[model samples]
Target chain A: MFRLILVAALACVITSKDVLAQEVRITPDTASFSVEVNGKLITIERNQDTNHKITNEFTKTSRPCPPFCIHPISAAPGVTTVGELEVIDFIETSVAKGNGLLIDSRLPEWFAKGTIPGAVNVPFATLEPSNPYRDQILQALGGVQSGAGWSFAAARDLTLFCNGPWCDQSPRAIRNLVDAGYPADKIRYYRGGMQLWLLLGLTVESPNA
Target chain B: MYRIVVLIAGFLIAVSGMLFLQGGQRDPADFALAEDIVIEDVAQMSARTSQAPATDLSGLTSAVRASLSPETVAAPEEADDMAAMTSGVLAGLGAPAPAPGGDDAMQQATAAVLASLNGATAPTNPAPQSLEAIISQSMQAGESDAYIDALLNEAVTSGSVQVPEALMTVDGRVDTRTLIAAIVQQSMGSADAAEIQAIAAEANAGTTPRAPAVQEVAGERLYTVEQGDSLAYIALIFYKDSGQFERIFEANRDVIASPDKIRVGQQLRIPG
Candidate 1:
């Protein structure tokens, strides 16, 4: 009888541990709350609709070339390509602290649809070297303009993202910023962008919503 | 007794092994349920709707017409004559009289005139143009390449135009300026030279000339780690052989720390 009891106890312990290991948990330990952006308290969460499937502008898989193509991982020698976690870290650490900017390098329409929390929309084209407003934009990003010259000593560290890995808007923006003399090391690339961001169950806020 | 003990041990081992196997086997139903919950939560959070906005054709026509200067609008006598001509055309086509003073009627009349000028039927299904089509249409409208460039630059800066995947190249890549140029070329094929010149002159009059192109130096190539990716696999993609994973490891030594360990979303440099 004692031997049988011992065997049963052992089985029970093993089974309990196995069950514990297999149980799935979905809720994040972090507190869910709204973040303030542009003087508005914006609540960030997944779409409440149970039928929400990803049908954003980023849904398309293909585009024409010579303009649209897969981007190289790094925009410049010092520019680091980061993932979602690093982007979140930057947001919590640098952006929240006002030491950096999380830029959504998509056009306004995409920004209106939804974007990462605390990101400011700056379309990639505005940073192009040929753009007449490029200098003004650089200045707004904290570049110091002098007579026919500029300095980026006070420029905020920028983390830029677009639709996702397949999207080139952010990459193009990064390249333009780099070419326009934005410090490469100060710019980080969030390659996962909105696609991966949503896939990972991170919070997104829509200005229109 | 020895035989009995051995048998018991074997039985225990088999039971434990079965438990372990069961533990590892995830129930698909459970996963589906969890996914459903996630979807439900997201849906509750965003309250997003799938219905597209209704197209206001009359509003669009009015906006277009309102953009025209007062000088551009015809005198009352000329307007009356044009109205008579429009009515004659409509009568000839056996169309009914338009509703008196209704915006819809005015919109129809304006649309008819615009259609006749373009030698096309009345517009139907007035969906907004995609960015690609808009850029193409701008080109066709005799906008100068410089003007279009400036317009695109302004639109991007203002966040009015988002990135369109249709502009991506076949290989799933995009060069922003190159894409703009291609769009212009595609649209310019049917554009009038005089209109293009006029728009170009107007755009040039207001804007500083574009600076000369600077020689570009190629920079380091990068690769983002993906799910199911290994150093060897990445090396094979870039080098066409797996043996050079060490080169990748060497380039990304700071971030990688070890070749055996890499995570999705980590960016690694591909050695030139």
Candidate 2:
């Protein structure tokens, strides 16, 4: 009886070890959760289509050059380059807390197509220094007006992205914001953008939908 | 008592033997081996660490890069050429010709404009109308619809006007006016200011008097949804009044379910 018990115990230990060895989890812990955007809670999950393929504007291989060339990893000094996971974490921590913004810097058409969950559309052209609406937008982004200048004391952290690495709209937007006196440290860049986000099988939400 | 002691001793020996064997089988990849189960635990830990955040950015970048096709990989260079070509075509349409000597792109653009104009006028007038003469005549004539069409057809036929594949409709036709506008907008600095103004005036002349506010090009006046576009915003762009978004919503009722929602890549009719 004692020998039989020992054999059974040994068998139990080996089975548990084999079971653990076969399990492989690749997604982040927060991936299974939901995120709140524009007063609605959106569940984050990859597109469930078993035969899913990227079929958006991002599938295009080229665009006008000079103005729309591939952007460098870093937009400017002090602005950190981040990927999808970091972007998700920021959405959870900063955006959900209302202390930061996830900015989709593409034009309205691109924004209308689809975007990463939790991102708000802010076209790069609308934020140009010469645009009459620039000051209004800056103020809305929590910039405070001081005497003869603007202060970013109350400004929320901003993470900007556009189509992907090959897109310059977000880089231009980031540079424009930094030039407009928004602090560089307060800005983070998701260099991967929509292309990488989709590639990694992350969720995308359309504003219209 | 002796039997119980022997059993305990046997268990110790078996446990020690297992530990000893595991120590000999230590994986070279492991940094430490505090427990017999450390190998599996370390693998899980390494995988968890990879999924944690930021540490494997290079790996992710490479994966994304690998997944992208070679066409996408070679896009930047092709984009520059396409942009130059687009600028050249727009310059040909009505914008001012680039300076006598500029970059290769500008030079090619100027040549393309000359070639297109030469082709358009070659059969009718032995001395081809200079780009300046054509623009001046079109503006003075105030007959932009026919004039622009003739010019675009000439350019398209000559293969000088290479519309990017993205701009092509399902039927493989391109929107000449939008193509012209995109090129003009993109090639702002390269084109002549007065010429651009004249072209804009002529283009707007045809659309402003139309009751439906549609540019009277050959087909339906359609606008593709761009990033950041809303119904109101698109209305503001075409109709100059955000309040007229309902007009667009009404026009696109078949495809559009909600006035507030518009998808990118959706073709919205700019009802006349």
Error of 2 at A128 (Å): 0.8
Error of 2 at B236 (Å): 30
Residue B119, model 1: Cα distance from true site in angstroms? 49
Task: Summarize candidate 2's per-residue lDDT along B84-120 as a digit string, tens digits.
Answer: 3333333322344332222443333333323322222
Give me the runs in candidate 1 sitting further than 4 Å from their true place.
A1-68, B1-272
Retained true contacts (fraction), each candidate: 0.02, 0.00
What is residue B183's positional error in candidate 2, in angstroms?
A: 29
CA shift at A7, candidate 2, in angstroms? Answer: 20
The DockQ of each candidate is: 0.02, 0.03
State model 2's lDDT. 0.59
Per-residue alpha-carbon lDDT of model 1 for A1-209, expressed as tens digits? 45864785678677767655443222344334355543556444444333345765455543322233467788667999998668767876777667788888775445666888877767664564634445656766788987777788899899999877766678878888887788898999988888888875567877445
> Which tens-of-lDDT digit does each residue in B1-272 have in candidate 1?
77767766776776677676774354678789889988887885465345343235554334334322243244332332234333322332235434232233334334433342232433532432456754654544344455555665556556666644322222222223334433333356544433333332343345322321222336867676654345654544455444567888888889875665676677777877
**Model 2 interface Cα RMSD in Å:** 18.3
Write down the worst ten-residue block by lDDT for model 2 chain A. A22-31
